[model samples]
Target chain A: MGNSFFTPLSWNDTGFILTGVLNTVTISLVAIIVGTLLGLAVGFIRAEANRFTNILLGGVLDALRSVPLIIQLILFSTYVGAIGHPLDPFVTGSIVLSLYSMAFMSEVFRGGFESVHHSMATAARSLGMSYWQTVAYIRLPIGLRAVFPSWLGVALSVIKDSALVSVIGYMELLRTSEQLISRTQQPLEILIGVGLFYFIVSYPLSLYGRYIERKMAI
Target chain B: MEYEFHWIIVFQKLPQLLNGAFVTLHVSVLSMLIGITIAVLLAIMKMSKARIVSLPATLWVEIARNTPALFQIYMAYFGLGAFGIHLSPYAAVLSALVFVNAGYLTETFRGGFQAIPKTQYSASKSLGMNSVQIYRYIILPQMFRRIYHPMTNQFVWSILMSSLGILVGMDELSGETQRLQSLSFRTLEFFIVAAVMYFLITKLVLFSAALIARRVFRGDL
Candidate 1:
């Protein structure tokens, strides 16, 4: 077992593990882009609409927020499969990840938009700017800046969560590590490598998030 | 052609699902109790003036927060087996969760600690109280009160994150659901019910926390 630990895994095995990293990044990027767009729309609607509409939307988002993402991923995929139109693991996993992210992202954006003072919008309107012009020129920029740190936090979380797609047989980093462990019988080294990979992916984003928060605080 | 949903299969299995929910709650609550105690110490250490006292705490929180909980669980359950220090699935999941909970709540707790004015500590010290007395009488109550809402939020997070235990072969709620669904082949119905159960559990936590907060902090800001 001692020598087995020291035995180097072949370049082929290392390449296979790195493939999982690619899938992880792809899934996270697609989810964040799609989720952010959808979330922005929902946040805008929730922030700008009347009280009744706000309450209606809030309830739906809250439901999505309350349910754990693991359940959502499993339910959505299995439901699709049961209906006789089986989704590719990547497709279904992406769909659920985006939907899960959308809930938190919309909440972040809504809070950001609300942080913009009402007087700013009122003054813009008094200056004869249309609602859309005010939103485009003034509100959105301020809100996005305000929400950047929180948005980064959510994005980091997405990368971490992408690991869960492994449960659905999507073959991300954690699943790849499991495969490597079985083949090599070196779970300790393999899993430590797995943790290092995640830390590499997430720590910079976390540092950047802290940097943004500090920068914005001024 | 219409597809029929046989939710009856799920209903018939309600007892087992409820047991799974109980397991979920048990793990989450136990981990929180153990984790929060360690978190308090870590929080204090983070606030220490000496790097010797603080750096290790900082490192633990950074690693735990940045990485996925799944990785921790895998490392505990499968990784440690290589070193011949094997743990049961439940023990592995629980320990990993405790590690995570402490990491997150350490920050929350430190923030709570920092939010207090230094004058309070000086005031208590000037009253001839010892450091232990100062913390017990002055710091802890305020820290707990100030951070109560965030603590509740973390509690809910712990509850949800505990679902990762399923991957390690722990028969928690998600694991039970997977087991039952595989047997019944009523995948959709079982998962839908499981989702509802999870939703209700989290909502129940929120609702009860609010109730307790109202009672505990009555007439206080």
Candidate 2:
């Protein structure tokens, strides 16, 4: 018993944990950026689309949101491999995560675009502004400005959901901590650290969101 | 594109998959019920002026809202196990779902409650209604009306999130699919069925929610 060694987390593991943190942040940032762009484009097109077009598009996007994301990730990862076109875990994870985020982002953006009151657009049109001019001059600015809180909300959720990407073998923070916990046999300390990391990153953003929302309400 | 489809194994596994779906539904409904009860109390506490009362409520909401549900599950499972207080995979996932639902719903309820006018409360008092009568007859109904849509959304979310159970070896729909695929070497077919099952469950829920909303709100919604 005296000669036996207990494996504990050493200082060397700091670098390992940091890599996981960085990977998580990088994947989330990529998905959020790509998703927001696609969402903005799709949402705007949908907002301007006729009823038939809107339904056709909304049905597809709604289906994306209906399924669980973990299932989507696993299916996509395995399906791609099953077919003749296998991809890297990072590549597959980002692609599925981005598409998932886009599904939600498009809804948030659609609501934002629609919140540009009809009367305001009519006023713009009455003043001899073209349709494109009104969209640019009035609708775009007001809608985008008003949706900062919700956009931030989606972005934060994306950050949290990024943890699920680890399932596909992309080593995120949770995945890294799981390894450490298993090696050290100390789950509580490691899990608390992970929770604290997320809380620290997320709490400030949510506070900012609330602050912006309160200011806008006035 | 060269992979051949073999769906026969998936067909034979249908009964097990359905059982998994039932477990998924049962857990999510249980979580939502517990979550709603806690949310209602937390919402009230959040609005209270007492520091001790509001602080813990705020903390719970923030922690639940900010952390990943996956992390919460792990904490309940492995983290608690570290301390000699073990929870089953089902218990861990259920508790995690409830924690998140309550956090999000507290905010939703607060919004609903605040939407009721202050003048209405004073008016109710002048009309000879006590606090209990006022809340039971007036405030509660209006709050529920305002919160109904969001609550349905939360229910759908809980169902979706319960899929996280797969990670913890829980035999919910996703977990069951994982097991079936590993056995039959038919990952795509099994998961595709599971995905469709989830889609159906959520759609059924939304349809029923819509029907109930129409009846309860008398088409106002």
Candidate 3:
């Protein structure tokens, strides 16, 4: 080893790492927002629909959830490219991540929706509110509040799983760190820095997840 | 559109793919077993009133939980090499996985232990049992019953995450599939097969876990 204990990090390289961090966070946020909405829609469709629609939607969700996200990413990337469909890596990662999150989020929403007593909906309907009005004004709010904690868990998972985007050359934090290590041959310092970066990002969410669980428990 | 689905290429690669599946199964099962041992120890340590025990366990759990499994694997595989401690790809992946699994399972088991009523412990202690005996007879069994579902869920998660070991050149199912896809240039076929195999194995693992959980926690389930 050329340098002892503390070799200074080049600011330029660290800047590159920071940009990667921003990409990771952006992808995770977009995935969570879009995924939650899609999941809520699908989950309600499954819950409120006839047997055929419920089964169809449930089957789709199960298939999506069962396949590993990494494999799904590869499949989507290849299939899209093969079909002569041009999409950017960021867009591809977001789409795949959103689909992945939707699988889990739908289950969360389903559980939440079920927790809202049927009487609530029936009462709202009897009060001259339309079906859509009851869902929008009454049921969804309560259901979403109940599901918030689980959604937080799903969000944390999404953040970590988004690292898989590196496989498709997303140049996220993990990928950037990998490149830095290869170039600088400073695996220890870079890995520690990268690990710390992940810790900084994930630790707060984990604590917040626990906080949500505790608050929900109350 | 011109590319054909080559059944011949798939059939020829089936044996090699099966071998890869075996490797995947081996790594997952071994890691699960090792992980449970680590988890149990960590759980006990976390629950222990002693600071000496709890502090390290807490730190380990926090660090491991916060970092991604992929990063952990890279650190184990590459970080240690810088310190003149090199592990083979298999060993590195397994160790990293065991560490990751242990972190998650510790929380699961801790939750299970917490769910047990304090009176149960008191009753066991009153029955002329020592600490060890009380733990063996009362706490451990009850903990498993309460956490069986979550523990099994973590096991499935661990299996899925093991696919990441392909990064370290473990040549598991995903690794083998990537190789086949490259050689045959049948992207869809090879990947579709790999995906189906993964789904089936995950289902099998989950099913067995559920069955075992039922048997163990018959009354609770």
Q: Give one clash count per candidate, in the order shown.
A: 0, 1, 0
In candidate 1, position A44 carries an lDDT of: 88
Residue-wise lDDT of candidate 1 within B45-121, one digit each (tens)? Answer: 99899999999999999999999999999888888887788998789989999999999999999889888999998
Pairwise DockQ winner, candidates 1 and 3: 1
Tell me the interface RMSD of every candidate, in Å: 1.3, 0.8, 1.6
- Model 3, clash count? 0
Q: Residue A189 deviation, candidate 3, in Å?
A: 1.1
Candidate 3 collision pairs: none
Query: What lDDT tens digits, residue by residue, belong to model 1 across residues A154-216?
Result: 989999989999878898888888888777777888888889988988998899899989887
Predicted candidate 2 versus true structure: per-residue lDDT over B41-159, tens digit per residue:
99999999999999999999999999999999999989998779999889999999999999999999999999999999999999999999999998998998999999999999999
DockQ of each: 0.75, 0.86, 0.63
> Comparing 1 and 3 by TM-score, which wins?
1
lDDT of 2 at B218: 93
Model 1, TM vs. native: 0.95
Chain A TM-scores, all candidates?
0.93, 0.94, 0.92
Q: Report the lDDT tens digits of candidate 3 across residue range B80-177.
A: 98999898878887888899889888988888878888998789888899999988988888776777777667767766777886687778888888
